[model samples]
Target: MRMILMGLGVVGRSFLRTLIEKSPELRLKYGLNPTLVAVADSSSAVQDERGLDPKEILDLKVRKGSLSGHAREVGMRGVELIRGVDAEVLIDVTPSNFKTGEPSLSYIKAALNTGKHVITASKGPFALEMPALIEMFQESGLHLLFSGTVGGGVPFVRFVRKCLIGERVLAIKGVLNGTTNYILTRMEAGLSFESALREAPGTGLR
Candidate 1:
């Protein structure tokens, strides 16, 4: 499977590293050879129609603190990468402002226009721009998966997609924000909300 990633921040980088480390196992287990066809960041973009060396991408990130020096085949902008690459999948991890979807929407649109399945964690795109994106994906017959947007490390998205196939969802209720939940729990337990919030980082709230 050919894939193009849209960002290389902390989460995106970690995802790439994990995928690279797991490729051999994935090939043997699933009879699939997943290739990172391209990568884009705020500073630069790189594309190889055949496939990009994952090790080279990680090395560039380690040396440049970004993907600036990975030998760009296109510019840094998301649209440029989306338009130029011919990958089957597009991974959108650009930082989201939550108010305006901005670059995420553009990148998603471009990929869908080019008939690529999109996997993004940009909440604004799914929350506000979902209708339009859904239409585009349906029209193009491509898939859009936003697992991290709904459940960062949890199984909520996968459960909903897979397990909730033909079942009716009567209701959905749970603590969505872990950070806020931790703080509120501490406040209810006698600790000050401020103190609890301040200690959230150490407890892995983020």
Candidate 2:
């Protein structure tokens, strides 16, 4: 699978690192060879039709704090970048903009219209436009995956789709936000809500 990754934040960087580490295993066990052909951050974007080095991209982001330092950086971003890149899939780990469902929403629409599948971790788009997005993806005959939006790594969405085929779900209940769950845990352990909030940033919870 050829891919374009947008958003170079913590989730994006970590995803690149993990993809590099698991490349061999993915190919050997699943016959899946995922090549990152493009990457983009808020400031800049980069592309190579053959393939872009995930490590090089990750290192540039970590060292310089922006993809602008990359030699392949381009002027395009968001929807324009998505349309320009030649890739089978677009992985969007962009930050959530719940109120507007912006950038990522626009990016997803562009990718589908241009015949690219999508895998997104960003929640805002789905939260605000699930029905429309799903309809678009269906009409395009492309995959639209958002497993990371709700469960991080738990595959909760997949479980619901596969296991609950015949069953009708009346109610769903669980703690979905990790930051809020951590704060609640701390409060249960006797810390005040204010103290938990103060400690959250330092612990990288929020």
After superposition, candidate 2 runs with Cα above 4 Å error: 185-192, 198-206
Local distance difference test scores for all models: 0.79, 0.88
Write model 1 residue lDDT over 105-194, tens digit each, in one string. Answer: 888889877888998877778766888888878877899887777644565888987999999999988877766777888899999877
Clashes of each: 0, 0
Q: Per-residue alpha-carbon lDDT of model 2 for 1-106, expressed as tens digits? A: 9999998887888899899999999999999999998898888999888899999998888898888867787888889989988899999988888998888999
Error of 1 at 95 (Å): 1.3
- Angstrom error of the Cα, residue 73, model 2: value is 1.3
Worst ten-residue run, lDDT, model 2?
197-206
Q: Give RMSD to native, each candidate.
A: 3.5, 2.1
TM-score between candidate 1 and the true structure: 0.82
The CA-based lDDT of model 2 is what? 0.88
